[model samples]
Structure formats: structure tokens, C-alpha cells
Target: LAEHVVADSVLVPGVALVGGGPGDPDLITVRGRRLLAAADVVIADRLGPRDLLAELPPHVEVIDAAKIPYGRFMAQEAINQALIDHARAGKAVVRLKGGDPFVFGRGMEEAEALAAAGIPCTVVPGISSSISVPGAAGIPVTHRGVAHEFTVVSGHVAPDDPRSLVDWSALATLRGTLVLLMAVEKIGAIAAALIAHGRPADTPVAIVQEGTTAAQRRVDATLDTVGEVAKAEGVRPPAVIVIGAVVAVGPDQQP
Candidate 1:
């Protein structure tokens, strides 16, 4: 079930940024899996399909990148340096991330670091949780007549935070699906922002926790009530929060 990703085309002493897809181990792309199998050293993030690590050969070195949500984590610089050090030693290093590496995964930063260190880097795309998670919950991000566009945003920062780049006011005006990742802690503020920005308070919202995994569960609410609903339901991290009419298009209808 494995083969060398580069074979003769790319050389060793390099890094492969492989997206491990959403939490399900089987969701990873073949290319990503192949790369992982070929790696001599794997630096993994906490959010990906970590169970796959057990499949690696005993000789492989596995380093925990420890990107736990708002918790103790290996600093980005440390992770970058670790990749560089291993690759510099002529080892095939794989940086396995959850969802698409470029989707709020901080993959570009790592790639840039490798480039500056004169290390070769290859990217393997993975399924992003933004779409797959919602889909797993029976929610289509876009529907024929319900929605035509969908916006994916990071909710790590609250709408009122000075560091936040999302234009909540603008987002509220768009009549499309809104997908929020890393936003569980701030769902109340997010929902409030949208409502304050003129979005209808009654817009349907769905919070799918642990999406795509066996532990997956969903809670429903209107935009005005999502914050409270999420709290009452104990919605936690690694969850996908979807907002808009598309939430109503799924098999389950709000009561």
C-alpha cells in the first residue's frame, strides 16, 4: 500500500508537506499516503488522522508537532527548524497536517523556511474539513437554488479582535454559505457580529463536531441562537460551524 513519492525525479534531503485530510485516516489522498510511507522522519500535527502513524515502519522517527488547540504546542519556528535539521541530514521528512495544508495550516510558512534553508519541498493536497466536514453532516455547502457561493474563514480570532482580518460586515451581506473553522470558542461573538451586520437573525446554522469521524454529531440553531445552542450542546474544537440557508437543505430539517 506504499511507494516512493519521488522515486528518481526528486532527490532525498527534502521535505514533503502532506495534507492528511480531515480526521478519518482513509480520507488521505494516495499521494499523501505514499509520501508518508516513504518518509524517514515524520513531523505530525495533532489535528490530522494521527492513527495512521501506527502504520509507519518501526525505523521511522515520529515527532509530535503538538498543535493542540489553544494549548501547549511546539512553536512554529521549532517545527520548521526540526524539518530543516532532519532534511539537512539527508532524511526524507514529511510534515503531515490536517485538512489542506494551505487552509489555515500554516504550510506556506514552513515551505518558505525550507526554501530559505535551501531544502527541497513538495506539497500534497488533502481534503479540507471546510467542505468534507459539512458534507459528512449531510450539509451541502452550495445547493442549486439555496446557495451559489460559499466562504471559508478562520474563526480563531473574534470579529472584534484587532488581529481579525475577516470582514464580518461584508460577510453578512453575502447570501451564501459561511464555513467557520477554529471558531467554536468564539461562535457567540461571530454569530453576534453577523447579526449586527444586517444578516438575518433567523439564518439557519449547524455545528458539526468531530466531523467525518465516528464521534461526529451536529446541533442546529438560527444565527441568533447558535452561540447558546453550541454551549448547551457542548460543541468543542475540531468542529466545523456552517451558516446559511444551505444548512436547511440537508436531510435533517430544523424543528
Candidate 2:
């Protein structure tokens, strides 16, 4: 299990951006956990596990590099500087992210910055809260009998032009599942677009927040009303929005 990833790439001399996996410390992969234990400096996101941070050696230096969601805050430049400084000290630094580093975790941006600085950084993938959240809430992204295909999209986009990257018309007709991550703010617009594009207004949808963690919460409703219900339920980000017939497979379960 562990050999496949690193064999695909090399662990470099600079910082390693590790995925902490959803919010559960236990969900961290074996190799990832091992790396955590060996890290000399650990920088993590807001959604990463508190318990995972606690697992680190007491002497390990830690930094909080989280950006305030939907708010103006820590610029990527500042984070890059932190990584460079730590690595320059010849310390084994790990930049831990909430979910998979590649999935909107800004891992790419940091990697690019590191590359420009002649630093060699490694990326360690983790379970994305997007897929795991939905599954934990009993909504499989794809079910053989129900859905054969699925799409995952970041819902954090400009409200006016959210469909720039997403083909709303085609997605509505996919008849497959659509898992939207970080879309709590844009859920209404997203669902409305799907409905307008022929996706059933009553399509079953489940909003799972803090997915795969002890704080996980699920809210079930149809596409037409999920946004409203989710709002009333106070669902936040660090969420996964699952939509399709598969959601009906376990209708009795509540989040």
C-alpha cells in the first residue's frame, strides 16, 4: 500500500505537503502517520485534526497556516515563506492539509512557489473529505445499480459565474452522481442551476459536513430544498454534497 505512492515519485529534500485526511486522526494513512511522527516541523490547515497535531513529538515545531474560509487572510506568499524558512533550517517540515493535498488544498500553489525557489517538496495524498464525507453519511458516489459515473467539483466559486468550469447542462443530465465540495455557500445557486438544466428538482441530495470525523453531520433533502434545509441546520464547509439515486439507498439514515 505504501510503496505505490513514493515509488511513483521521490521524496525530496524540502518540505512535504501531507494530507491529514478529513478530520479524523485515525484516518491518516499509515505512512502519513509515520511521517507525522518523524516530522521536525508541522504546519497544518484549519480543518486538519487537533488530535493528529497532538500526536506529534512535543519537541516538533508547529505552525498554523490556515486561510480563513470566505474571508481575507493569510496570503499564499506568507505560507510559502514559512515553508522555505523551515526547510532552509534543514528541519524535516510537513505541511499538513485537511484533505487530499491536490484537491483545492492549495498544495499546487505552494509546490509552484517551492519550485521557483529551487526547493524540492513532496506531496502525500490523503483521503479527501469530499468523497469520504458523503460515503460516511451513506451516500456512495457511484453505485453499480444506481450510478455508474460521478463528478466532484469545488463549490467555492464566483456566485455569478459558477458554471465557468462546470458544464451545468451536461452535468444535470448525467443521471450519475455529483459530489460538490466546499459548496455550502453556493449550494443554492448550484442546485438551482442543475434544476434549470433538467436535473430533477426533487433529486435526492445529502449535505455532509465535517465528513468522516466525530463531528460529522448529515442533512438529507431534495435538490429543490437541500440548500434551505442545510442552512437551517447550520451546515458549514469541510463538507461534501452528494446528489443522485444512490442517496435514496439509505433513506432511513439521518445525519
Best by lDDT: 1
Per-residue lDDT of model 1, residues 195-245, tens digit only: 999999999999999888889998999999999999998888989999999
Model 2 per-residue lDDT tens digits across residues 1-255: 011123325444677888988887888777677677777888888887768887677899878876413244357778888888778778888888888899888899999988888778778899987678777887778877888988888788734593567677788889888988888898998899889889999899988878777788888899999879988998887788898888887667545
Error at 51, model 1, angstroms? 1.2
Top candidate when judged by TM-score against the true structure: 1
- Summed over model 2, clashes come to 0
lDDT of each: 0.89, 0.80
**TM-score (C-alpha, index-matched) for candidate 1:** 0.93
Whole-structure CA lDDT of model 1: 0.89
